[model samples]
Target: MSAPANDRLFRRWTSRLLLSAILLGVCHPLAAAERPNLVFILTDNHGAWTLGCYGNPDIRTPQIDRLAAEGIRFTRALSSNPVCSPTRATFLTGLLPSQHGVHSFLGGERPSAQMGPDAYCTIREFASLPKILKQAGYVCGLSGKWHLGANLTPQEGFTSWITMPHGATTEFYDAQVIENGAVRKEPKYLTDLWTEHGVRFIEENRDRPFFLYLAYNGPYALGRLLLNPARNRHAEYYADKELLSFPRDTMHPWQFHNKDFLNNPTSIRRVAAEISGVDDGVGEILQVLQRLGLDEKTLVVFAGDQGWMGGQNGLWGMGDHTRPIGAHELMMQIPLIFRHTGRIAAGQTSDLLVSNYDFLPTVLSHLGLSDQRPPQSPGRDFSPVLRGETTPWENVAFYEMENTRAIRTDGWKYVARHPEGPCEVYDMQADPQERFNQFGQPAVTDKQRELAAQLDAFFARYADPQYDLWKDGRSKAGRLGGAAGPAAAPPQRP
Candidate 1:
C-alpha cells in the first residue's frame, strides 16, 4: 500500500474504534462534549522569567505570552525537584522524588547499564497521569523527550510516541531521534518535528477525546550546547541585540560548572533563539486548535518541566549546577498557564504556591475525575482556584534535591543540608535576592527553628524509607556529585 493509503486506513480504523468504544459504554456517560481533551505543552530547562508574560523584556515569546494573556499565569508555580528526570517523574506520577525513587537524572554515564539490558521504565510501577487518563478513555500521545528510561518503547499507556534517542541534547540539528521503534538522525529542527507530529495527532484524533503531551526539549541553555551560535530560524533576529534581561553579575562563588558561558553574548543570543523556536511551536499548536474549532473543547496547558537560571546570582544552569545544589527562587519557579475558553478563567494571575506535584491532582479534578487521583499524594487539587474561586489554600511549598532540602513560606526560606553545619535562612521579604543568610542569627533563630520543624515533619510524613537520603536511603537512578562532583553517589543504607 502507498504511504497515504496506509495513513487513511489507520485513521479510519481509529475513528471506528472510538465510535465503537463510545457506543459500548466504555466512555463516560456525560457525553463527549463534557470530557475535554488535554493538550499539555511541556518545555525543557526554561524559566518563567524568560517569557514576556513573566516580565522579561528581552526574550520574544509572543505565542506563550498570548496564551498567558488568555488564561491564568501562575506567579508562584515551582518544581518539586530542580533537575530533569526527578521533576519529570513527579509531574507524571504526582509523587515526590523521595517517594518515586528517581533522585537524579537517569541515563547519565551508564545509560545502558543503569536501565539494564531490557531497558526499564522507571515510573512503570506507579499510577501515572497518562495511565489514569488512558483508563478513562483518552487517547494519549507523546511528541518529544520521554527521558524516564525506556525511550525505545512507549511507556505509561501512551499510544503515539516520538522521542529523542537520549534524554540530553548535544545539538538540535541532525540529532538522533527514536520513532516507531527505530533510532535515526533527524535532519530537521527537533522542535519543528515535534510540533508537526503533535499537529498530526490532534487532527487525527479530533473526533474523539485525546491527550497530547507536546514535550519540547528546546531552550536548553546548558553545557557546551550554548558554545556555538544558534542556527534556528530566529538566530538572525537576536544576533545583534544585547538582551539586557539576563543579569551581568559576577560569577557566583557556588557555581561549579559552565564558568566560561557566564555573561557571554553568543550564549545569550543562542538561548534567546532557542526560546523563540519553542514559541513558534507553541503558536503552531494553538493555531491548529483554533482552526479545527477545538479551542474550547481542549484544556490547553503550557508549563516547563523545571526552571532554569540564566546568570541569575551568577548561576547559568539549574540548582544542581552548584556544589551544594542551591535552590534559589529562579531555579525552582516554572511557567504554568492553563487555557480553556469558557471553563478556566481568562486574563488572571494566581499567587498561590503550587508545584509539579500538584499538577496531576489539579488536572484530574479539572477534568471531573477527582476520584481517580492516586491515594496519599502530597499534591492538593487547585481546580477551584483555576475556576476563579476564592478558596483557602496552603501558603507553603517544599523542595528536595538529593542531600539538600528546603522549605518556602510566604515570607521565609529555610535550607537544610544532611548532617551538615552549613545551612541557610533567608527572610525573603527583607532580602528577596537572598543576599544575607540569617541561619545562626539570634533575631531569626525562633523563625528558623519553626520552619525546620515544619520541614522535617512534612518530609517525615511522605519520604519513603528506601529513597530518603537523609536517612541513608539509596537512589534508583544515576545521581549527581551533589555535596561531594557529578559522579559521586550517596552512602548506602545498611
Candidate 2:
C-alpha cells in the first residue's frame, strides 16, 4: 500500500512540473518575436518642403503625406553632410563622413581615380547599419542607389541587394539597375523598381523579422537637368501656377547667377513632376505592407539622405561652400518620419534637434537591443522621445561640408568657416530665412564664441582622423570635375 501511494504522488508532481515549465517557456521574452521588422525608405536630394505634408502646395505626395499623418514627423531633421555619398555613409556607419572617409559621391571609375587613393580605397571601419541589424538575427536587404562605393557589394549585413553602382539618373522609363553585383537592365521607372524590390523583400521575409533599405533615386535629378527640366511631364501637370508667380528669392549675393535657371518655367514643372513620381512609389510600398498584414508589427522610416539647394540662397546644387550655402537650414534640413501602426503614436511632430547619425542608435533602441560595446559612434538613441517619454532634446544638431561647419541650437545657429572665412550667427527665432548675419554683433559675441568653441571641440572629437580636409590646404574645387576656382561653374541649362 505504501509503494503504490508513493508512486502515484510522484507521477502527479512530475506532471505538474512539466506543465509549469511549458507555461513559463511560452511567456519568456525570447520565445516571442525578437523585434519588429524595420523598413527604411530613404530618398536622394529630396527637400523637406517638397511634400504636401511639409506644406509644399505644388507637389502631391499623398503616400508620404499619409505616412507623416500616421507617424511622427521631425520638423527640424538634418543630415551630417549636405552631399549624397557622405551623408549616406554617415547614415550607414553612424559616423560622419569626416570619420568614415567617403566624403564625396562614388560616381564612377573615372571620378574615383581622379580623387586619389584615400577616397578610392577607404573601407568603412565601423559596423554598418545592416551588419549590426543582421548580426542581431534580422535578415537585411537593400534596393536602389548604393552611392557609398562603386565596387563594394552589400557585404556587412545585407543578405540581398539590388543597388546601382553609379547614381541612377531620374528617368521614368528604361533605367539601368544593378542586381546584387551585376548590372541588369530594368524597363520600369527608377522609383517603381526600387519599391518593387522593397516589396519583394518584405514578401520573402514575412516569416522572419527583416530590415529593408529602399533608397529611391527620384526628385533628385531629371538626368542632369538642374531644378527640374521641361521634359518632366508629371511636373507640368502638377505645377502650381500661383506659386510660380512669386519672385525667385536668392539667399546669397552670388546665387543671383542661377536665378534665371531657377525661374525657368520648364525646370519648375519638371521638379514638381519628379517629386510626384517619388510620392507614388512610396504609396506602393505602404499598400504592400497593408496587403501582407505586416503593418502593425513593422516600423517604417521615411527620410532623405541630404538636402538640396534647388536655387535657394542662389545655389543650384550642393557643395558650393564659397558662400554660406551648406550652412543654411534649407540646404541641410531634412524630413524624418517614423511610423509603427499601433506601436508608435500617430500624427505627432518633434522639433527636437536630431540628425542622420542618430538613426542606428534609434533602430537599436527600438528593438530593445543593448547598446553596442566600445561606443564606436557619436549618435544617441531617441527612442525615449519616440515613446512619448521625453520632452524636446537638449542637444544641438551639427553640420559639415568640406571646409565649413555649423551648429544649430533651438533659437540660435552659429557657423564658422576655416582659415579666416566669414563667421556668421543667426537668431533663428527672429530671422528664419537667415537674411541677416550677426557674427560681429556685440550683443551675441559671447554666445557666438561659445558655439565656435563647441564646434571646434566637436571637430577634434568626431571629424575624420585620416585627414582634416577642412584644415588641410587641399580644396574641394576640381574635386567634382568642375574647374578649380573660388566658385565652380553652375550647371548648364538645356
Candidate 3:
C-alpha cells in the first residue's frame, strides 16, 4: 500500500476511537458537564383544557401527555396577556405589556411600518431572555413566529433565526421564511419544516449548550390553519371517533359570521387535525432528542402561547385578539409542561399560580443562573416548586389584554373591562366556567374588595406614567382591535 493510503486508514480508526470516548461522557451531555440544553415549544392559540393530560379525553395528544407523565404539569399556567404580540413580548422580555410598551397586537397593512424601529419597542433596550441566555453561554435559535416586534430584522441574541416576517401565516405552503436576514418563499409543510430545522439545530449544536425556541403556528384559526395536501390525516380520524362537539347555541352575541365554520362538523375536526399535527411534531422532536442521547440532559418545556375558546362560552374563534374580547377562563389559561430526566419529578401536578413572566427566572434558576436578571424584571423563580420542594409560591395570578384585566386566586377570579357596565367576578371553585357573576353581589363584597385591591396594587408597581393604561384609565378606550388593521388576520403586505 502507498504511504498516503496507510495514513488515511490509521486516521479513520483514530477518529472512531475518539468519538467513542466522547460518547462515553468524555464531553458530557454533548457539551460541558453542568450546562443543559433548553428546548421551549411554544404553540399558538391552544387551550390548556384541550390536551389529553389536561382532562380532554377526545383530542389526540399522547406526546403532550407523555411530558406530563415524565415531568411537572402546571394547572394554572397563566398568560401574561391573552393576545399574541403583548404576551409574546412578556415571554421574550419577562416584562408586562405596561412595562414593555407593546399593549396591542401588531401586523396589518404596513408590516413594514409595524416592524419599523419606532413602530413598536424592540428588545434592544431591555434585558431580554434570549439575550441573557446567550450571554450565559447558550446558543439561541428561534424557528417560528416572532410577533413581538421587528419581524424582519433578527434580534440581538438569536445566533440562528428562521422566521415568518409577516408575523401571521397559518398555512405551510409557499410561505415566506426569512433565514438569517435572507428571504425565501418556499413550498414546504410548516409543521414538518420547522421541526426539521429545529432537529437540524439540535444536531449541529450538540457540542455546545443550546437554547432552541421551537414556536409553532398551529391551532390558531381553522380557516387559515395550514394548507396541507393530506388534510384528512386526523380530520377523518376525529369525525369517525365522534370527537367534535360545540356545547353552546349557534347565534350568540360573542360569535362572528363564520357560519360555514360554525355549521360544519368537519370544520371542528380539521382544527383537531391541526392540533394532532402539532402533537406528532412534538413526538418527532422528542424522539430526536432521545436518539441523540440529549434527552436526559435537555430540559424540554411545552406550552401554548394563549388558550383558545372554540365552542366555549358562546364563542367561535379564540385567542386574546379574537372577536370575543373578554378574559374568560378559556382564553387565558395555557398548558405548561416541563420535562427533564431527574431535575423535575415524574407524574407530578402542581396548582401553583404561575404566569409567563416566571418562565425566564425559573429556567434560569434550574440552570443555576437565577441571579442573572434585570432589576425591572417581574418574574419570580419557581424552580423550587417545580422540584416539588416546599417553598412559598405565588398565591394569585394576574393578567390583561387591550381592554380587559383580570386577577385570580385559588377560589375566586375578578375581571374588569373597558366601556363596561359591571366588572366580572367568579367563584372559580363553584363556577369554573365563569357563568355566574357575583361582582356586585352584597354577599361577597369583602372578597371582591380584597381581590380588586390586590390586582390594582400589583398593577401599580409595574405602572409607568407614560406606559400605564390602568393608571391613566386608558385601558378601556385607548385602542381596541382592527382600528388600524385587522387584529385576527394581519394583512400580508409585501
lDDT of 1 at 469: 74
Full-model lDDT for every candidate:
0.85, 0.69, 0.71
Candidate 2 has what TM-score?
0.83
Compute the lDDT for candidate 1. Answer: 0.85
lDDT of prediction 2: 0.69
What is the C-alpha lDDT profile of model 1 across 47-147, one tens digit per residue? 99999999999999999999998999999999988888888899888899988888888775455522346577776667788877776678999999888
- Pairwise lDDT winner, candidates 2 and 3: 3
Best by lDDT: 1
Best candidate according to TM-score:
1
Candidate 2 per-residue lDDT over residues 350-374, each given as its tens digit:
8788999888788777865534411
lDDT of 3 by residue, 312-366 (tens): 7656554443453567777778999999987888999988888888887888778
Question: Candidate 3 at 135: error in angstroms?
Answer: 0.7
**Model 1 lDDT-worst window of ten:** 485-494
What range of 10 consecutive residues in model 2 has the weakest lDDT sum? 485-494
